[model samples]
Target chain A: MSITGIEIRHLRYFVAVVEQRTFRAAALRLHVSQPPLTRQIQQLEDALGVKLLERSARGAEPTAAGKVFYQEARNLLTLAEQAAERTRLAGDGRLGRLDIGVFGSAVLGPIPRIVQRFRQTHPQVELVLHSLDRIGQIKALRERRLTVGFNRFFTEEPDLSWEVIQTERMVVVLPEAHPLAKRAVLSLAEISSEPLILYPRTPRPGFIDQMMRLFHQRHLTAHVSQEVDDLVTAMGLVASGFGLSLLTDSGRKLHVPGTIQVPLRKADAATVDLCVIWRRGDDSPLLAEFLQEARALRHPPPEDAEPVEKPAPRSAKRKRAPKRR
Target chain B: MSITGIEIRHLRYFVAVVEQRTFRAAALRLHVSQPPLTRQIQQLEDALGVKLLERSARGAEPTAAGKVFYQEARNLLTLAEQAAERTRLAGDGRLGRLDIGVFGSAVLGPIPRIVQRFRQTHPQVELVLHSLDRIGQIKALRERRLTVGFNRFFTEEPDLSWEVIQTERMVVVLPEAHPLAKRAVLSLAEISSEPLILYPRTPRPGFIDQMMRLFHQRHLTAHVSQEVDDLVTAMGLVASGFGLSLLTDSGRKLHVPGTIQVPLRKADAATVDLCVIWRRGDDSPLLAEFLQEARALRHPPPEDAEPVEKPAPRSAKRKRAPKRR
Candidate 1:
């Protein structure tokens, strides 16, 4: 006989006998016959190659080795029960880590609010945020490092799914002394010839590409002043009177001392969208709950929301749209 | 469905499917049919109320929740296997604690050797030694606080069993300058009128009682001097030339600077036996192994080893006995 020969039932029976202090009492507690209980304890001892209990005329008592086995068995049973309960909680998406990939100005506004709501609802889940751009987000998602990603201008992918969480019309950042800063709203065509500081020089097909596409669609060439790494660098250049910069409504939250933001003419301004992306068929409940929270805060679109590839038509449709809060 | 609806087999099946990445592959590995394997995974997902896998023409892949559950299930299965293996080891006496009650001079000699040998053989077993006297040993054994105890002059009780491990001849401790210390051996009658320091003032029916009984058996009155607490105090009194003290051979290991030990004449000396006591019918493998080690160091008796109550007859039998090493 080997360790494998001992079964979970054998442990239950032996523990019952030792606890109840009599085979007859154990059988009654287990709702089994006394002979069967005795035989099972015998089999357990045989499998272990050591006697676990000493039986007398009065009752039964565990030997020293039996006491040790009893504690181990009880712990194992408790762990087994806990495993099932934890697995169920995991399936419900309430007891695991959610790694989120975030980027740029999105972290300034909507993302923090959504994260706070998620924390309030699912307190047990750990939330990890990785600051990654659009291309990095997609790569991390495919590598299973990110459960979900939030960013702008995500191109369609066969293995990834994207959903528009919010839409913001473009805004232009100008130095406080610039002539355009006095206007309530400025048309992009009016400042197309002005020195413009575009951001995020690397990771092509990003926000810079979308900005260039907006200028090209209107038959205007942006006078490029300097190309920098991120939104903060571009805003800094604008603050120092180097050039004017363009941003989404979310970027307005960054209040530079010497810079002011002016809304763009809705007819000429392209609407930029913030969308969430994940693996195409990820059915994780955590992802579902997060998406639900995002949808709850979704901005009502002026027109049907479309991917960044078709930004020209969205601008044309926004000509008659009313201003939003 | 509730967590209780899930079984260990369901977890096993689900983990196999997730690891193999397909029902057919998992079935091949588990030696089961694909239909039943698919059904089991479905049942597991249903019980959890979560979609654990995404099935496509390529293969079945685990969802995010499925990944979490897979880890938990694997850990639970491993713990179950460990539980069985640990219980078997405990039963085999190779993986538990052996709490020993030790007192007085027994810690000096044979006890340490037996403990060292036990450690070499069973490295995983923990040995806890509690300094307890004869009465304390009996009480701790009854309370299940001690797996085994070692001391001298243990009275047989209904609930405790004892075996003589070693039979030690008595020795007289005196100041090195005393005339009796020059002799190789001295009889009890010669020292009957000498001031004798007795030890263990409390816990009567102990070593002091055994000493008084030995003198009584010889019809000699002991001229008791100072009564101290332990072996060290008695030896200290002997070294200071206050009074002579008697101890078993085991106590000879302690060498007080001005004191020397001389053997008691075998014909008049009462043989003190070091015996191990335990709860009757303990049958713990650890206890059994410890007893085996103790018995291996047993000193062959001059005649038959007897309990402390019958030490007089053993002394009579040892009159013609030769000296032991």
Candidate 2:
């Protein structure tokens, strides 16, 4: 019924039979006599309660159940090899896999730099990123399916610990030539009173409402001109003078040709914050190194910036910024 | 160069060498001799261009690459078994697998019922759900990683086609006992004046922003007290009297304890559109049946609500709905 009951030797024997086909031929191929191969197959059949192979006049054919067992056995072997390779890549604080879940916000500002640096430093880890919403990231983390997530407000996951890497004020997006573009700074009312573009509520509707309500409080509203769900599309619209939009400042780094950002005069001040989220219980050294890299990216801390200092762990990141000349 | 280059003889020889550890011992076990066993190993190695067994005086052992190749061989054998199992389960238009990607909305509706009914009717076909966002679903569908996705507006993908199954209008969310809730229906402006909870923009601000701006045209501004990226949290906020929220009648299906979804007077209408998206190029009969099952869950056609209908070709879904009653 389980792995504990199966012997690696059984797979060895099954593999033997599959290779040579004829019990006689397999015995010859193994340089072993036929009786042990027969015995091993019998033992395996008895253990599994399924006939793995049938000896036809032509040769041996795998029975239905036998085939399933073979793949499982093979996967186990592949895992074993991968484990060994991981061990070889271990001391450098890297695993053969780097299962990452990146929130859309993480791709903003210096995130691209962090990703590039991490990749160069740990070329051995097989990187897998799940572009996820905050909820999706939490669910996957709870399932032990995510190794790391770069996102906003770690959401107080029961066993997940978080570190704020950077923060930006949510900014109003407008076409550079839009009249409001020269306002220097604007409130929610000003933007809501203008043509607005936003995502409709199939999913990811929280930010749109947050921005709209900031205007609602001021007794103002936006004349929504377009409904677009893709962030890139919304940015394009804003750039193309379709309508203005709002998003975090780091996202400003993804600036399109004709768009500009103005800090909101009032609203959720930390909407643009990015945090590195990891399971609190995980103590993988590699995770620590990556976190350090995130910290280093905030170097020289911006004006009025409160560095999210957590005793700055040692970083093995490649060549930090060159010292002053 | 190919799988056919593989032979039964090599399998047997490999198994024997692994179990016996040395060609000499394997030869004894098989009652055949050592030289032929060595020849099989050599030929297998040559075909794969990798060393299989490393033999020195210490006896034979598998190299890491040898182990991985052995594992792959095992998977091929497993597929053969699954092929046979399919034959057994192939009747009644039920067999194989239906790999589906469920968008956020489907997770709330009759999807569970449809899936359960289908499973009950066809015990053989495996129904696998991959929870994905619109973009993720699109990527998976294009990559053939998912056979189907349930969502809104399956568009821009020439490789995918859509059949809208259900459409419902958006509703303004508020505490069940809020003054606005007492109104028969409120406009987007009425809701906008209150603190709103919303989804954060990932690629785009979720649809809430444009809906908010419709309020802006009326000089109504939304007071966003806090921002949340998930519907559950947004609903929770309304339930907790933290702020007002918005959702569709269908979106409100996940009723948080104190939340009420009321109609909007201005009808800043948001749509709860559910469509089934699949690769246009794939015409798997079972996919057609599953599509039928999906449509059936909303009680399809009914002579009035059929948006667009397409029938499955000759191939049956690994499982299908019960002949649509």
Candidate of highest DockQ:
1
The digit string of per-residue lDDT tens for model 1 on B229-296 reads 98898898888899899888877888889998889988985787778888886667677777767776
| Model 2 docking category | incorrect
* Residue ranges of candidate 2 with Cα displaced over 4 Å: A1-325, B1-93, B203-206, B209-227, B264-270, B300-311, B315-325
Lowest lDDT block of 10, candidate 1 chain B: B309-318
| Residue-level lDDT tens digits of model 2 in B258-278 | 777777653455455677888
Name the best candidate (by lDDT): 1
* lDDT over C-alpha atoms for residue B309 of model 2: 39
- Candidate 1 segments exceeding 4 Å error: A1-63, A95-103, A123-147, A172-246, A255-261, A264-270, A299-325, B1-43, B51-61, B94-99, B119-136, B143-147, B154-156, B172-245, B255-270, B299-325
Cα displacement (angstroms), candidate 2, residue A162, comes to 91
Q: Write down the RMSD of all candidates, one decimal each.
A: 10.7, 36.8
Count the clashes in each prediction.
0, 49
State the DockQ, from 0 to 1, for candidate 2. Answer: 0.01
Please provide, for model 1 over A287-307, each residue's C-alpha lDDT reduced to its tens digit, 9 standing for 90 to 100.
877777777786554365453
* Model 1 Cα shift for residue B315 (angstroms): 39
How many steric overlaps does candidate 2 have? 49
